[model samples]
Target: MNKIISALCFSIVALSVVAQNNPSINQADTARQQRETDQVLREVGPGDSVPSLFSEEDADIGPQTVLRKKKPTWFRGTADAQIFYTDNMFFQDGNEQEAGLAVTTVEAALTTPPCITRFASYRAEVGYRHQFFNYFGSDDVLAVPGTILTRRFDAEDFDFDSSTAFAEIVAQTKHYQFRAGFDYTRLLGFEPLR
Candidate 1:
């Protein structure tokens, strides 16, 4: 149960990280595409450069979504890593007589894109962990029927994945551009607040 929860939390963190990592890449792609396509027109009419400031819909505030140009695309990359140490090898949870085992971790990551319009990316990472636990620790705090007591624990460690997949889409007009996409996340898990 803890592992499952941990995984879910890790995924949430990773998602947020990816979202923040890329801001105008999509917009840049859209803007570049627009500049390329709009260049064909020699004359720039007032209407061309400036579309309707407000929605043209007869209804008031009707879907006030406006379009705008995007910036030029530039190459993007990242490098991340971590290191860890622990006394528990299994990292199980149960009873804790002492302060529990201690652990440290170190990890890293690196990713790159294939093209601007084409949403493609890959990442890699690796880390180490070590810990020490005792019998009172929950990792071995099992309740045996006959013995009516728990067992002592030993070593433990942490687990982390070092890979990711990402995608993005960009749309634009004269004044605004919108972007949406998904990407792989790592140990940085997610948990929505109530």
Candidate 2:
């Protein structure tokens, strides 16, 4: 019957769509775990040395607490003491002039939550970043390259400030994770930020 054939076609198409989407749901969470496993495998099996940054015996785990922390991990520090400067490089536009821009960003995190078995745990992270730019362009043009103008000023406005901040809560188990966060961004448009 034609109705049966039509139903079969629709079912095939629906199955195909679901099959395509299911892999991506698992891909993102599994990616980090797979990389960690590969790093461990390479270090132990091939004599490839990967430095263990933290001592294993120092992990803090409570016997009576809800979490069973067999392995505790923690790291927090920053190592950078340098200045950066950049001049006009040129992307594309009629606006042309020398420029100066500087960017400085700092972030840190501490994840020491105990585990609720081999399958579940809670984690949180917080970070912030900021950037600034000062681009001065010329709108004055002379009839000749060396010709002088009585008074010159550019009639252009430029974007000169940007910043972003983020905080995330990550609760995860063996096969899945739930994440919630607040993200604030100030990285758009040429309007002056006050």
Candidate 3:
């Protein structure tokens, strides 16, 4: 009985050691997996013929092909007109006055299409805007002397116009985006207090 038990233990230990150090068994398994993968690939045909999600109708399916076309350059323009009443048209803090004003704004812009490089994509845009403000129903705004806002404008002169022009460039990468822009504004009929 002792001999049988010892022999059984020795065989088990030898089998474990041989299995742990066997390279041929591992190679045989890898070769079998590769053969199965090759067979599946052959049955499925080339990867280029597979259709991906949201793919364009004319796009070619391949590793190196682009799936979408670049956006085209465009031009846009907008105009808005509004009329409203305000309790304090001149922005006086302590003293308030009631007035109605008409406002108009116009904007136009042109944007270049995206330009893609090796590291990032870039776009450029240029725009201009013109805004006008004409005040009404404020006949008594200048009736009192030494008013806080009276020094900025002449009697009964509360019309204002402003023009702005801007240009900007944006660059975007996989994880970050950068933007640089400049704008210039010119104001008319608005002045600082004396």
Candidate whose TM-score is highest: 3
Off by over 4 Å in 1: 1-74, 81-156, 170-178, 184-194
Local accuracy of candidate 2 as per-residue lDDT tens digits, 37-59: 55564345333444343455235
Q: Could you tell me which residue pairs clash in candidate 3?
A: none
Per model, state how many residue pairs clash: 42, 0, 0
Least accurate stretch of 10 residues (summed lDDT) in model 2?
A: 61-70
* Residues 1-194 of candidate 1: C-alpha lDDT, one tens digit per residue: 99999999999999999987786877887788676644433234333443233456435544432244343334444343333433433444542223243323232323232223323222222322222212223343233323646454322222222233545554543465665656664443222245
RMSD of each: 22.4, 14.7, 14.8
For the record, the alpha-carbon RMSD of candidate 2 to the native fold, in angstroms, is 14.7
Candidate maximizing lDDT:
3
Provide the global lDDT of candidate 3 against the true structure: 0.75
Q: Rate the local accuracy (lDDT) of all candidates.
A: 0.42, 0.54, 0.75
Clashes of 1: 42
